[model samples]
Target chain A: MSAGVRLEGLRKSYGAVEVIRGVDLDIEPQEFVVFVGPSGCGKSTLLRMIAGLEEITGGDLYIGERRMNDTDASRRGIAMVFQSYALYPHMTVRENMGFALKYAGVKKPEIKAQVDEAARILGLDQLMDRRPKDLSGGQRQRVAIGRAIVRHPEVFLFDEPLSNLDAELRVQMRIEIARLHSELKSTIVYVTHDQVEAMTLADKIVVLRDGRIEQVGTPLDLYDDPDNLFVAGFIGSPKMNFLPAELSGGALTLVEHGGQTVPLPPLGRAPQEGERVTLGIRPEHFRKEGSAALEVDVEIVENLGGETYVYARQAGSDVLTIATGGARGLRQGDRMTARFDPSDALLFNREGLRIR
Target chain B: MSDVAAHRLDPEAAEPSARAALRGPDGPGRDMIGPAVKYIVLSLAAFVSVFPFFWMLVGTTNSSYDIVRGKAWFGDQLLVNLGNLIEQVDLPRVLFNSFYIAIISTVATLLVSSLAGYAFEIFRHKWRERIFAALLLMLSIPFAALMVPLFVMMASAGLINTYSAIILPTIANIFIIFYFRQATKAFPHELRDAAKIDGLKEWQIFLRVYMPVMRSTYAAATIIVFTLTWNNYLWPLIVLQTNDMKTMVLTISSLNSAYTPDFGVIMVATVITTLPTLIIFFLLQRLFVQGMLGSVK
Candidate 1:
């Protein structure tokens, strides 16, 4: 029912300034792919290029088996839900859902049947006569997705569709979208600046930075094993903590950790003795019972109902956060040593490339 | 123990010198104009704006003698004035001529101008911007300056004494084009992109999506264009050589220029000529408000 999307050497430039540098990717059919990046990282631009809303400056874009760089958007058989919903203001919800099909020369009853099916799926049957301006934000977004559904498009493109909704509504709609993807069994390319959204909804996540692919992997794979500093820093919620360290005699010594040290395990290509490196530890990786240890001068503590985050630091050093399960009797100005498994430490060279 | 010092602080702080004097030397808290004064000023403005229409209405109900005497109230001579107005001008035939010319020209003008506006804005090129700037500059040029050459062009085309002479010259109105260009800026580009994805052609997108989305803009444009074309005087007077070809404006003006002009009859003609514009305004006013609201959204 859906086609795979592929981009080879995809590039976009506005005269001298290239917004999208060379990007290469292949999205499997029926896969939920999320494009996540910081602002100006060209994630939305990339999505728009696939939707054919933006012109391909230099690359081959293929939908199904067709080279779609020159194909009209409507002919490419893809549908997009814009950030603004982009619904016709004067048209009813039913009309908005049915409009594209009507113009595609479908029979009246077939259009009605498709629209009715989409409405039932979206829980918009009762609101069919309502205008976009009259609907709530979440309802309007549902109608927008309904509009896309009626097109029977091969792939779906969503550009920050939930960014405009409230926090609760965003979570609700995120699940709704994930369910839709599964139900339709169509390839979906979703773009967002939010890592959380990418993590929950994506079957595979594509991390973009400065118009280049930084990393492409499953959400947990990226969190557990990032290729570089950017992916490691971006994927985790309480961002993985980095402490300056030096390797000497197969041992890693924390340069700013009050003389704390741990043995370095052998890697694919180990660093030289006395070479500088950064050791990354996720906040949740810290434990009360482990081998490697560093004493921390606690500064702030945030306790959620389920877990508590201890934001602490060594003397004259940046804050390193530690997450411990449940309520721990921790206080600011309380000095304590937090421990972590030696094998859990991630080492990066001065250039931010992984040492292993 | 510190009564005088506290008293000194009270007076100093009681003064609102820290705030600007633009709020009438007092704070806005104390200086807001009361609603009574607001209503008074608004009523005066309303009276000023409506006075001329009221005077015309009164004149329709008065005789020439009473109108010259500055009778401001309704008189019992309305039937007589109407009879005289129809007597001088073949009222129905002249109105039909004006209506046909104005409506057709307005529809044409809106189409051409809005298309030009949409293209100039959406499909921008280096040369199109230059042309748009030139069009804006042309708006500053008095139509009177172009009148003679325009008439000659119409005459050479053998369109003299025809409605085409009047309609053709004014159909590509620079002002309306500028207006549509400005309004078209507020149109969301995403709508067009969505329409394109729906398989609409460029022209079909313009016709189906843009036309419906910018409905308020068109309504406002329609009322404005209709009024301007209906009240068009100088060009039609020069080109439309026959009395049968004359518009309401030319007809009414000729009635006014009679050696012994009947003031009451001219007023009746003026009142009747104004009715269509007023009716159009009333009918489209709701649309105008709705459009304004939509534009803001």
Candidate 2:
């Protein structure tokens, strides 16, 4: 049976500086939730608190319907896979998988069966007798996951489980984890700083910054409708670009780009005419030709076979990245015209909060 | 005709004269001389370090008078030295006492220290860290300063002349604790968390998970603690007041102090005292080195 998790105003602090500042979230049963943030943003801390590995400074954690704030990690029916794939170095893969089950009051036969089933799922049947040192990094990671799987936990917690892997192995393991989630249909909470992993594996992504939640939504929801500048900048690769602008007469005019302006749809209320704003645009949203255009000096062009990214400057401000299809003939110091639809732009206030 | 032209045009065919021109004169002998001197120096150091053990073996086969005269080879006095060693001490009992203490102390030290080390590393509480730092400070306090108080404590507990008196005081040793703590820094905390989620309580996790995972560390600690406890002369001499309870080191000390002290017999006793530790080290040498590397990493 599976269970949902509810963290109500969960907070963690060490020596007065709060690492997790009052996080509240309701994770539905069998949903894969990812806590994505930069290092030290307390995403791992929040996951640990839910796993009962870290003590909650304040607020309540409920697994299913039971309050788990004071529950021991084992009693909470949770299993965790760590970034280092902390398999027992001395034990065989089979023993490593069955070690916890031995203490969980499972019969020897049952334990062996469970371990065998987990090994089969992780494709580690041939490596059952091998110690961790004898296995490669991917196999060792599989053993670690198998150790967790044999427990049949109601909730699974993963603390940056694929960070130690190389790029190719990380992608492979990421797919394996997605498949495992679907197969087990268990509620999972995964933490990582890599937004690609977060976007790909998560049923719901919780974007975090400075120990606070920036936004929580589906991956596409976050990409399309970020609630803050941090979320917009963090969720996408190549990151969303921000340019200084001013709101005037239902029009957002780029202040730093030689006064290039775009008319905005009429809002019931408007900020002061000269109020400063941030114009956010994803690199892929930049069009080669459109009704609105901004002339920029191309400083660098990276041709990645299928797509080309142009790093350019408009009116001598921060560099803006524009991703275009196919190989481009753009070169350094070449003047280029970049265009986009007005609807593609995201508007944020001076304080980095989304304005609309 | 074309093949004949290609063979004539070949580089090897054309380079016979150039080969002699490219052969330069021999280089200087400086490089060979450096390694030659280094080998001589290293062999000399090895000789100096190993000479005493060789001398002891030779002395065991010589008469006491001949040994005193610095005789350096085997003689017909081996039987006589063995006889004297047996007469002067209960050799078997003394050897047994040394072994029993070392084995028990090593096992107990590994268990207690590894437990404490794992606890300190896995559990991140304020007081535990403070206690750990305090333990390190305690390690720096010389054992000589605590010996008298420790002796008094043992005497009050009615543990005088008993193996427990010697073993108990050194069981919670700070050095072993510190060694385990350092070794434990390399232990993946993820393993502990995994064990916890696997439904293992603290002690179960320690015994089943931590102990098995840290085998190399335990092996190194066993050698170190065994060597230290087996060669423990002062504490054993002070605590073991009875002749029957005397360890090998204490017996050797007493044998050297006797009137007309038998050098041959003393050599035998020295060999007996040193053999157990050497055996332990030889047995666990690989694990010991591996453990050391793991800790430093």
Candidate 3:
């Protein structure tokens, strides 16, 4: 059975320094929500607080209809997969998976049935007799997942579970987790610094920064319509390129690039003349057919067979990543005109808040 | 060819042969001298350490007069000396007393010390490091200073002449607590977190997860504490009054301090006293090495 989580005015502090400052969010039942942020942003701390691993300094936490702020982690009906896997080194896979059940006073045959079912689901049947040390990193992670699965909790918490794996294994396990989530349909809260993992696996993504929520939305919602500069910059793979500009006479002028001008996109409220702003554009948004163009010199070229990313810039200006679709001929020092639609670019005020 | 002619004929061939000659065993660059010195030093140190034990074994076979005369060879007096050792002391009672005290002290010390170590490392509080530093500082105070106070406390409790007095003082050993605290640093804290999530109480986590994971540390501590408790002579000698309560080491010392001491019998008792510690050491030798290196892989 799945249960929803609601956090209201959640706050956590160590001594005088507050780490999770006034966070409020709702995780719907069976919704896979990912908490994404850079290091020291309190995403993991928030997840831990939700899992009852950390005490709430001042807040209300509800799992299903019951308040869970003071509940023990085990009693909260939640299972957490740690970053280190956290498997017991001395126990075999079977014993490790069944340890909780054994301690919970489950009968021997019932514990065996549950552990065996989890093992089958995770494809850990052959490895049941092996200790954690004897298994590969991927296998150990699967056993950790199996250990959690055998609990059959209402909510699942994952704390960067695939971060310790190699890239290929990470992708493999990511798909495995997605498939598991789909099968079990349990409310899951996952924490990760990797934006790609958040974007790919999350039904809803919560962007946190410096102990506060920047924005919370569906993956595409955050990507297409970010509420702030931080969420816009953090949610994408190749970071959005920002150009310092001034809104003068209804047109934006690039201050650092010799006054190159582009028409400002229509906004809900008109900005003041001579208002300083930042224009953000994604690398892939630079299309050949767009109306606006910037003449620049290519400094470096990175070709990954399918798409090439050219790092180019004007003289005395910051470099911008431009995605050249299958243009293999571009090389360093090649002068080119990168173009994009004016409507696709976003503007931010000087305070790093989105203008529209 | 002459050296100059060979170099002139083929520079590549000449250079390789010259390099090989310098690297060869008999060459000036050969590294034999340092290793030879090291081996010589090591052999001498080994002999210095082992000669006393060898002399002890030989003393057991020789008579008292021969031992005093510095007789180095084995004689046929082993059975006689063993018989005399058995007659002078109740061998079974002393042996039982030593074993009982050592085993109980070892088990209790490991439990109490490891729990303290684990708690010190895992739990957070304002006074944790201050308390630990104070404990470590207490280690610098010589046990001789505490012996009188400890004896007085034991006497007040009416615990003197009791095994409880022997076992109780050693249970909270600071040195072992330090060792376990250091080893517990290597323990993965995530396991504790996982056990908590799995619904284990703190003590249950210690008994089920920590104890098994830190078995190497336990093994090493067992050998050390067992040896120390078994070889403990002064405290037991002072507290234990009756002949029936004497430990093997105490009895051996008493035999040595007699008006007319028998060296052969003393040597036999010494051999017997040394055997249990040796057996424990050998049994836990591998794990002890691993524990000294690190408890967790």
Candidate 4:
């Protein structure tokens, strides 16, 4: 059975420095939540705090109505898969899965049955007798998962479990994990620095930075409607481009490009006229035909078979990425006109908070 | 150095057998000079280290006069020497005493030292490092310095000539504890965390996960502790007074001090005393190497 987790004002500080600064979240039962951020962003710290592997400096952590702040890690009714896969190197996969149950005084038949069932779920029946060192990285990762699955913890915690695998294996495991989440229907709180993993696996994504939550939303929601500049930049590949602008003459005028102005749609919280702001636009949003257009010189052309990205820049401006058709005959230093709907542009104030 | 240079000038002249025997399938480098030179040096080193044991074994078979005359070959006096050995010492009793003390001391020291080492590493705190530093200091202090007070404590406790007196002082071995502590650092902390999530208590995790994962370390410690306690001479010599309670080491020392010391009998006794340690080292030599590798690395 899955359990809902509620963390209130969760604060963790080491000596004078606070790592997880006052995080509050309500993770629903059976929800697949991912905490994603850059390295040293306190995402893993928050995950470990919930796992009870770390002492909570201050917080109220409730798992299924039980306060877990002071509970021992074993009593937390949780299982974690570490980045290293952390399988007992000396034990066979079967023994590693059944080790805790044996120590817990579970009946021998029950332990065997549980381990076999978990092995079947993880497709590890053939590898049950192999020690961790003998298995390939992906197989060892599955065994690590099987060990956790055998315990049937209420919540599964994964800390960058696929970080060690090669790219192909990581994608395969990512799909497998999504399928497992659906089949098992267990609450999971996964932490990763890889935004792609977060986008693919999470029911809800919690983006964090500097020990604070920047935004929390679904993958598409974060990509489309970021509350701040950090979430907008962190969530998408090819990254959203930012151009410095000043609100003038009823439109945002590019500060770097002289005499260039882009029209803006009516926003819920518009910035003051003549104030400095950042105009945000996703690379894929640029089109060959639209209401707004900008002239740029192509800096680099990346032909990725299906899609080509034109890295272009205006005079006195940073390079801007524009996702264009593959092999459009665009070469470096070629002048191009990129266009997008005015409504597609997201405006952020000088402090980087979203205006709409 | 000249030999190396000579081979380097014409690398094609390298010995095929040396390369074939010494080179691993995917091992680095092409030169046979390194491994060839290594083989010669290692065999010489092995002979140098093992020569004393070889000399003692030769002496065990020779008469005392012939031994003093520096006889190098095996003689026909081994049986007579053993007979003299039995007459000079109650062989069974002393062997039994030594075995009992050694086996018990080794087991106890391993348990105590390994646990301390595991704790100092896994449950690290500021004070643990400070206390560990103090222990390292204790290791540097001569055992001879503590001998008088230790003897006084044993005498006051009415434990003089007892196995407990000989075994007690050697049990809290700082060196072995230091080794275990360093080895424990190499143990994957994530395994401990995973075990915790799997519903194992701290002690259960240590016993089930950490212990099996670190069997190499304990094997190395076993050989080390057993050898140390088995051949421990000075403390046993001073503490054990009665002939019946005497260890093999004390008995050998007693035999050596006699006016007409039976060198052949003493050699036989030394051979008997060293056999168990040699056997232990041989059995766990691989584990000893791995354990040292883990700790030092």
DockQ ranking of the models: 3, 1, 2, 4
Candidate 4 overall Cα lDDT vs. reference? 0.90
Give the clashing residue pairs of candidate 4, or none: none
Better of 1 and 2 by lDDT: 1
For candidate 2, the lDDT comes to: 0.86
lDDT, candidate 1, B66-94, per-residue tens: 99999999999999999988888898889
State the DockQ, from 0 to 1, for candidate 1. 0.71
Error of 3 at A40 (Å): 1.0
Residue A94, model 3, lDDT: 97
Q: TM-score of chain A, model 4?
A: 0.98
> Which runs in model 1 stand beyond 4 Å of their true positions?
A255-262, B1-40, B292-296
* Candidate number of the best DockQ: 3
Q: Relative to the true interface, what fraction of contacts does candidate 2 keep?
A: 0.94
Give a tens-digit lDDT track for model 1, residues A1-356: 89999999999998789999999999999999999988999999999899888899998999999999999889999999988898988899989999999998999999999999999999999999999999999999999999999999999999999999999999999999999998999999999888889999999999999999999999999998899999999998899999888987788988887657787744788898889999999998898878888888889999897999999988878899899889579899999888988688798999998877
Per-residue error for A82 in candidate 3, Å, reads 0.9
Which is better, 2 or 4, measured by TM-score?
A: 2
lDDT of 2 by residue, A253-346 (tens): 8888878787653333566788998888899988966666888999889999998999999766789999987957889999988888767878
Q: Can you give the lDDT of residue B73 in candidate 3?
A: 90
User: Residue by residue across A138-256, what tens digits does model 3's lDDT show?
Assistant: 99999999999999999999999999999999999999999999999999999999888898999999999999999999999999889888988998879999999998878999997
Q: Cα deviation in Å at residue A297, candidate 4?
A: 3.3
- What iRMS does model 3 reach? 0.8
